[model samples]
Target: MSSIDFSEALDCLKKAQSVLISCHVRPDGDSLGSAAGMAQMLGSQGISAEIILPSELPDRYAFLFEQARPRVVTDDWRRAQLRGFDTVVIVDTSVRAQLEPQYDFLKSCNLPVLVIDHHLESENIGTVELLDPSASAVGLMVAELGEVWPAELSAGGAKALFTAIASDTGWFRFPNADSRTYCQAWRLLQAGVRPTEVYRSLYMRDSVGKIRLLGRALGSLELFCEGRLACMSLLKEDFRQSRAAQTETEGLINESLRIGSVIAAVMLTEDENDSIRVNFRSKRQINVARIAERFGGGGHELAAGAQLAGSIEQAKEKIVSAIREEFSRSGEPGGE
Candidate 1:
């Protein structure tokens, strides 16, 4: 939770000759956008920077990189690539668990690490950490960095940054979208970012399989804690039946929050490896991130996620029990 100033982060980058950028696994718009934006910012400054992902880039975000190809690391030996860079910049997350495939390299590499994240929890994963819990998105932090670094945002960079801030704020519909978020959005718009195109690329281009996946996830919805909580799951069979890619599960959990009476929602998906991916979202005072942390996960107060090794049913039971316990501790009735 200790955040460093932008000047400090800029100073670290100022010393780097080459940079390797990265974000959390299962890259979302926020993480992808921030990483892309950071790469562009560094590139404009004449620093050779490239993005290295722990996983494949989601198809929905492929438009952001029409001009560049980010390296997707698939093996342990790829860790040697870390030695080639003077610095590593990890956007959107500071948790070691989220770093995944690169976690070992990051832990062992002597190269300076700069973490730009807004999550409430972090491991001592960075040599210079720019952790800001107040910023709505790490992209917002990057936008602010552009101003301080005095770097110009290319048309692509503006679009990438806009996607970062907008996605993390639920397109400004979430409670986290404060005035700062809107102001940054305005700045990107002034920089010639076309929101309509970005919106269409992100939302309107869903594959049919994604629609089927959404339907299946919604079909599994169950009410809990007297209708105050909603839980949903998508099994391995669900994915096979829907023919949906894992990335399509991105926003499924948020749909349950649309329920008029539900204050919190959970989405549990069975990964191919049989691990359960749990995503938590809330619309009120409950800190779902705290609940996630109990199970070795962390995120913002209202939104968070974790992965558990168990059957989907077992994962659901543990998650539901934890949410109910959190509700009880928060002094809300009907937690039983």
Candidate 2:
């Protein structure tokens, strides 16, 4: 709510001789970019910065790293790294719980735990918390910290931050995107990051397997709420049949919204263990987070998601039923 106190974030950065930045487990562009942007920005101040990613670098975002990759960590390494850093900054994630294994390490950090995130569900785990769900990500919040940023950050830092903002805000298509997102994006552009290149790298760079997986995902789609809702699922087998990784299905939930009469769209992916991961997207007048939260998940109103302990088909049915109930309240077919 208050202007993200870069003065506050800077104080922590300045105190640490060495800094470590971390993001959520399944690192999206915003999480990875926020981590890299912080590293580049702090490098300008002569501070050594590192990124600790929970998983391997996803394929599409590998290009963003030219010199270094996120230091992949085991659970033990994660704790040790969190302990050794002069300061640890958690980005893109609101609560430690969302980060699985690092949840406890972040809490026990001796120096300071600083949280710069945009998720509304944050658990406020840092000594210094600068979280605004209204903003697109911690990268956008970190971009505001350029006042204290070192000279080295002006270019690479901008690209990382811009990519984070662009991805999390659905390329600035979501309603949550505001003047702050666009203004910061324009600022990053001025810093010499090519918008077209970033776009090609982020969205346009999918593999052929990914394209086939998307088609299969769409083929499984069904409509509900008298066509106001659309939902689908892609199992692990679907990815194999399409010769795509699970990541290939990344944008399938978004495509569902393009249909006429669609008020809400959901895509459930069956992970290796058969537990379902849900992705939700919607137009106005529906709050996906409300539905996600009811099922022990969290995110924003317009776009939110959750992980469920059920079959993909069961998850899809539950989510679709939730959507039906949501629209019914509006005097629609399911209710109104």
Query: Which candidate's TM-score is highest?
Result: 1
For candidate 2, lDDT tens digit of each residue in 69-140?
Answer: 777767557354455568888888876666767667656666688888877687777898877777766678
- Which residue pairs collide in model 2, if any? 328-335, 331-336, 332-336
Check candidate 1 and list the clashing pairs. none
Q: What is the Å distance of residue 127 in model 2 from its true position?
A: 1.0
* Candidate lDDT values, in order: 0.88, 0.80
My TM-score estimates for the predictions, one after another, are: 0.95, 0.93
Question: For all the candidates, what are their Cα RMSDs to the real structure?
Answer: 2.1, 2.1
Q: Which regions of candidate 1 deviate over 4 angstroms?
A: 1-4, 76-84
Looking at candidate 2, the ten consecutive residues that score lowest on lDDT are: 75-84
Over all chains combined, what TM-score does candidate 2 have? 0.93
